[model samples]
Target: MSGETNRLLGMAKEIMAQPDGRELDMLASTGEQVSVALLAIALQALGKQAVSYAGWQVPIKTDSAFTKARIRSIDDAKVRKDLNAGKIVMITGFQGVDADGNITTLGRGGSDTSAVAVAAAIKAAECLIYTDVDGVYTTDPRVVSDARRLKTVTFEEMLEMASLGSKVLQIRSVEFAGNYKMPTRVLSSLTDPLTPLAEEAASGTLISFEEDKNMEQATITGIAFSRDEAKITVLGVPDRPGIAYQILGPVADANIEVDMIIQNQSVEGKTDFTFTVPRAEYAKAVEVLNSSVKAHIGAAAINGDTKVSKVSVVGVGMRSHVGIASQMFRTLSEEGVNIQMISTSEIKISVLIDEKYMELAVRALHKAFDLDSAK
Candidate 1:
């Protein structure tokens, strides 16, 4: 698949042209279509009725954002028709069609998002997402040797974990499942094929809408870290009306997602404003500010750090427990890890720090909050 993308890119380079997002989608979508067709063929080889369909055939509708499309809705009539006929309907994920009939892909973890959306559309009782790992863990196993796999997690906590950096589930999938109150389970793709259906179904971490009272709650459920973080500061801007919008509006228009915003107190009617964006968009975001916003906003200068990372502690138990942030800060403070930025929500607390200190921060915080021993 990447070979095909590269071929297209190489052709474009020869013609002195950049690959258009639309054409890129047209090429990248072929990969998923191939997988679906092969799966359908394999199922048919077993003497089971099966059919394969592309996103446009399933008509999974989405906004025409090209590379980073959003699922607007999905038409399940064809899928239901095939299923009612006792055929296994295999459809491509990650890519969908727009009202104008153009193919578009959901960003990096689109497959999971597509699955959850389709499940909700068809009113499926539950959606199981099969991945490389057995289930969601306290943290990445490579990062923490004793990281434990969770049997179940509230949708709220999972959402925070996904957004913070847990790769077991994509953030949008968690958001979709939570929004629709849909039951989603993360299962291991490497499970034995002959395992009992009942036993297999009960395996993995269930992202449930309700907390399991039978399980003891921990103040911190997991440690999530993102090395793909970058922070940008619009320094010395006027502390007046619409200032935040003035700084961030163009950024939004550029389709660069911003996170963890901070505004310092007004000093003589001027303040320092800072926000974080994905590391990949760091340069583009800085370019956007320099060319259009800098002089207009009369700011001192635009500064950014592409080598930063975000580490977070997420848990629903924080609503009842206190000192989570204090403990987190103290833990980092003791490790001499300097936090560059801070953001918090009811169920989570995230800190942006030097990228080099990310692992040290995660290990220390994981142990400090007793996540290593958390069930």
Candidate 2:
């Protein structure tokens, strides 16, 4: 159990005045309900009324997928009735039900989703998310030591950052906050509890819908890297319509997510195609493609490489700027870093470089973007 979980549990016990009480757990509808119940007891000690409720109890309805359930609607009347009756609701995040009434959970980090849902249901003025980090930094502090904490961040920029992989806040939570127009504060729970609430400054990032013009913009927002990638090569597929589909169909059926695909024109009426997928699914994808598509396309062979990483430069400012990608490529070239593949979005640019060059590449790009400088 984490310290925060333990503290909440201890607080629940103190408030309840009973070692064991009827607690509701709003868990991920997966398993975090155990932690919720434990925390309820801790809340009791602090003289705060507490109860843990699962997504089913709070009945956060959504689609029936167990791991990545999407919430459909919440019956807030029951929640409001409980809160009005003096109950501190500890509901689970990440799982809900569907019209057919099946248990589903939002994917990973759904706990943040649960927090925002509860806040919105109760119309709380602010939703404070306590995490390990003190707050949101100008850039990832681990990458840029001088990365300063932002008092606030706009919803759109934060969404782009989170989607690009700033794990401080879940993308869904930010979306929920923006939709509800709620002010969400991300704080570190590690701060001293004895300090006055006002004096206990929030150390992490605060995400809101408004932007601060006074806050100078950094050319790059942060550095995000992912190693969960695998490259796939399909040799000698006929140059024709639906060939790409015929090749990728089985991989999709096998639930492998393909990324960064490239198909070159056929040489002598036979073309070569390549793409990437999650490293874990590499074997399955290759197996399916080799077994099914290979014979159909007269493919010579299927090849897979799991030892690759995608490092990206993310910033909303890039939308208005030119030469960002060129500068990134130049910096990597100057460092003798060879890029294997490349991908880009309006707000982000990602390149697949040698895994060995991951850190060196990130540092070079960070410096090139002037992210290490104080704004």
Candidate 3:
């Protein structure tokens, strides 16, 4: 799939100076289009009536954001009609069309988002997401061998984990399911072809709205880590009102998202500000600030580190638990992992750490929280 996108990208560059977002989405969406067509063919060969449709065909209307489009609404009438006619319907994921009839794509986990959105639109009983891994784990299984497959996780915890780095399901999909109270399951696609329906129904991780009574209120439900983070610091800025906006406004104007921001206490009326961005946008963010913001704010030099990563512990128990923060810091400290910045919410605690210690930090946190199934 990536090979196809890359080939199109190369072709575009050769044929034109640079590919615009509209064409980029037009090119990228073909990947899903091809898959749906093949699946429809396979089903037909198996003696089942089936049909495939693309986003524009269904006219899944989206805002005109081009590559990063958000689904405004999904017209499920066509899918329902196909299903009513006794035909299996396959709809392309990750791509939608605008009212202007321009093709757009939801960024990153857009396919998962598409699936959930469609399920909600059709008011399905549940949405089953089949993926490579069997289900969501306490952490990346490769980093922590004993990471447990959660039978069920609360919707909120899953949201935090997905945003933090538990990539079993993307955060946007979870958000969609949560908003509409949709029951979404993540199960493996590798199950036996003829697995019993009852058994398959009970397998995988169920993401629900706190509907699982057996879910333990573990202080740390999971350890989440992401290496795709970069930190930027603006030094020696006046600690006055709106200073933050003065610094971040331009970055936002440039479409750079900021996360885990910190501002040191004023020292002689000046403070240092720091924040994190997706590593891919770090260079562009710095350039935006330097070009349009720095001198206007009368700040000192700006610097960034693309080698940093973020580690977070996510659980609903954090709201009522004590010592969670201290224990998390202690675990990382014992592993020689230094925390650069910190962010927190009712269900999670996030800390920026040197990229080299990311896996080490995750492993230590997993052990500290006793999330190991073998234990």
Per-model TM values vs. the true structure: 0.88, 0.80, 0.91
- Top-scoring candidate (TM-score): 3
Worst 10 residues of 1 by lDDT: 211-220
Model 1 RMSD in angstroms? 2.9
Error of 2 at 82 (Å): 4.4
Best by lDDT: 3
- Best first by TM-score, ranked: 3, 1, 2
> Worst ten-residue run, lDDT, model 2?
19-28
Count clashes in each candidate, considering only residues at least 3 apart in sequence or on different chains.
0, 41, 0
lDDT tens string, model 2, 91-158? 86666666665666677668898788778877887788988888776556676576667666767667
**Which parts of model 3 have CA positions greater than 4 angstroms off?**
1-6, 23-27, 211-219
Candidate 3 lDDT score at position 108:
80
lDDT of 2 at 131: 89
Q: What TM-score should be assigned to candidate 3?
A: 0.91
Question: What's the ranking of the predictions by lDDT, best on top?
Answer: 3, 1, 2
